[model samples]
Target: MAYNVLSVIPARKGSKGIPRKNLRQLGEDPLVAHAIKKSKKSNWIDHVALTTDSQEIAQIGRQYGVDTIIDRPTRLATDEIPLAPVIEHAFEEVDHEFHYVLCFQPTAPLVSVDSIDEGIEAGIDSNADSVVFVRDSTHIYWRDGENGYEPVASDRKNRQQMDEIYQEIGIFLSENHIVRQGRRVGDSSEFYEVGMYEGIDIDTYADWILAESQLQRKQVLYRLIGNGNAGTGHVYRGITIADRLFEHDVLFAVEATEDLAIEKLEESNYDYQIFENEPSFLDYVRSTQPDVVANDILDTSAEYIKSLKEYTSRVVNFEDLGAGTDHADAVINALYEHSNPPENHYFGFKYFCLRNEFRYADPRTAIPSVERIMISFGGTDENNLTAKTLRALSDLDHELHLDVVLGLGYTDQGSLDSVTATYPPNISVEINQNVQSMAEHMEQADLLITSNGRTLYEAGSLNVPVISIAQNHREQKHPYAHISRGVLFLGQAEYVTEENVRTAVEEYVTEREKRETMREALEGHDITNGVERIKQIMFNQNNAD
Candidate 1:
């Protein structure tokens, strides 16, 4: 059953904080109009009206077409008087038989219909004296002591370990009796935490500036897809882009089946949602109405891109080869090459988005001989090339150190461990996962053996000599791994024999000048500034629209 709710937006115009604040513009609407329009959209909120002392405020209220406007006395309108008496007078003036009353401050323009509904729903379900809308605070509480300010807690603790403290945003839904009694809340209350940004109240100029800044940034939804089979490169790529877009409101949407993506996202500490299928995902897109949809899933279908365009302002697909390139605003592929591509399609190394650590990585332009060998087949190593390549090298007579880097999603850790134990004491093996800094390892290595993917671009940036083996046919098509670009392009893993890998490893190990030449050739390709370039492309397309 729906609750009968009355929303009263209070806006007293003559202000000490900021003059004409209620009438002042916030984004496109006046401050008071935000609550009024948002309240009207609530499915559970029955009626929404304005109660203000200023005639200008009332005129703005009527301009927005509120259901009712209650005039407040000059005495109750003063800054000295609290909101309780003003709300108390307005409740008496309205004369409506409502199940509950909601007081939304005009200063809080960030409030949404969803937040209001959540508060009301909590009030009804819990049947508390009031429902207090609050936000989670991590800051340590302090109070003015006899001599100086003192900590509110008995002991200091980390933010994660400490119990969450709910600080009210001065927005609440209370029982009818409490409103009549000139009280905003009672003894019993349910604490409902609003979104971090939505609870922002514009009290002072600093808060007003912050609210305005938040309004200016776009709401971006990153549609990331990954799994044990697909590999976590796409997920990491999406996270890199999301991390770069710290200015915007970035939210990730991944499939429910992509547990690897979920685990990685959790470790990255970002906000995300899980959907079962395409229909539910599109429903989320409609509800979110994201300004831009950035898809990091390698290829996107024309039908999928078309569906996303309906709900978003701009549709951007990364590493896309599907027919969707023609329909999408921008299709940026950092690896593949196309002879006759769609007008919207952009293919090449310039669009590659590198991880943050690579930005500071120095190129090992000169290496005397191959001492440290780095082997990585991406996160999943879906092809099981790491073990095959490791086994292929076990017969090597050369004295060298092998550094095996596997993905977190790698299923056969046991196989890699067993192979590591078999290596001679002179030829050591070090296996690493969830590497804090990929470039650090790349910087120290004389030669790197990796799959033909985004990792190739990372190696290219640091002039790390690479032996590329294609993970699949799709990866074989990537032109960046070719001999011309400083990498020895071995055919797909299945076609390449264990002898073929060992032969190549022996050649690089034995030939000192060959590895040096490849390392120097890598310096010609400029791939470090890709993340910035990609950001420009996404924003340029958005600006064009």
Candidate 2:
């Protein structure tokens, strides 16, 4: 039987130079991501394996489609250790027979697919016992005999006469025979020269800075795909929850077209797969098979839902309407329906309920002293009016802090970014705070300057007086009425002027007794924790089923 080619990436935890350098974000990806990506792209190698002493690196390697991971002993990861011993150690643990193996370093963040292919091909094609990648060095030279200061070359300008200089960059490929023979590289060896940039290794601060500069300054990058939209609110809410539950690097499979929701997702810079139509949706889901899927759609088919259930154990649904139509493993909804209710329905808190689930802090002293007020309209702005409200509040008399939140559904991020750049500095502004820790940020606010959306319920639940900007007709009728009763809703088009915003801030500042009155009305009203309770219910039901 022909032996399969195996790739090994050894990543150790302890480092003397940079702390946790493997996980550091370089440009759009982490340092190790470059090596992992190159390994996956190689056609010659059968399996891309990672041998790591760190659990965190293993988790990260798994995300990028590593076939098998070998946990190395602490002894092998030390700085004094040799690569040959570690490589031999991995062979003992895996107990797999292979024709050839490639040793990859996790520190190189710019390895190319061709470089991997070249090393593997050289090993197989040249009938060589071992192959290693080396690069030409322009920076290093040795003095002639007695350490003379003259140029190393007899004729400095002679292009062809200069001796070619090359150095091994530690990326090597060898057959099992070479290692079993107890030799680092066998007698028959081949050297494959790669580019200078691709040969860079990240070990010290200098190496890290150079790699980061290369990544960040590189022009012509792949166009990023946006997170899909069920609605602007739905996308941000889902991302908020997903970010908290999993690491920030987790990807979500969303059922959305290339709409505003997806665009917003793109702007927020998340790895996502979008299903354009029903048939495409199935193909996309089967191919990607994400760890967890956050479904914002109301109309997931029974066949698709069942297929998803079979494929993965974790499927969380965030539905605005028609939640129980096909029955997801877990469903988060604002209201329950009799005909099609989810098996484990989450229905205690509204989507925009203020995130005031504070247990460690006092409310009275905490509330009034909050210098900043953040006004956000969920993921999609439905109406792009939150920016206007921030502009209006800029004219307030007492030099109050103002923050405006942008949704993923906003028409353009460039316009918003530009507007935010020009907005007065005394007023702080934030975009797409998502839904996760937004409540924590909101809990510290003296007041909420917001639109009459689900966030109003969030503020009302906390009894935070709102200078409501009613951006839509529906919101004007629904949540704007609270603004009149001190929950303060300004009409979508009418009350959002600079003068009105100043008046609202003045009233709230002057009336200290009103703060107490509102607090009493809102006490014991928040119930966002029901999401957790529903999660438990779904988990138990899944086990039962």
Best by lDDT: 1
TM for candidate 1 is: 0.77
Poorest 10 consecutive residues by lDDT, candidate 1 = 536-545
Tens digit per residue, CA lDDT, model 2, 212-302: 7665431110111233222455555544444343312355455454465566567767676665665776566567564454556544566
User: What is the lDDT for 165 in model 2?
Assistant: 75
Runs of candidate 2 exceeding 4 Å displacement: 1-122, 125-128, 131-173, 176-181, 187-231, 245-249, 253-259, 298-304, 323-326, 334-342, 350-452, 457-463, 466-515, 521-545
Candidate 1 local lDDT, 195-264, one digit each (tens): 7788887889998888888887898888887887777778888888888886687889898998888988
Counted clashes in each candidate structure? 0, 12
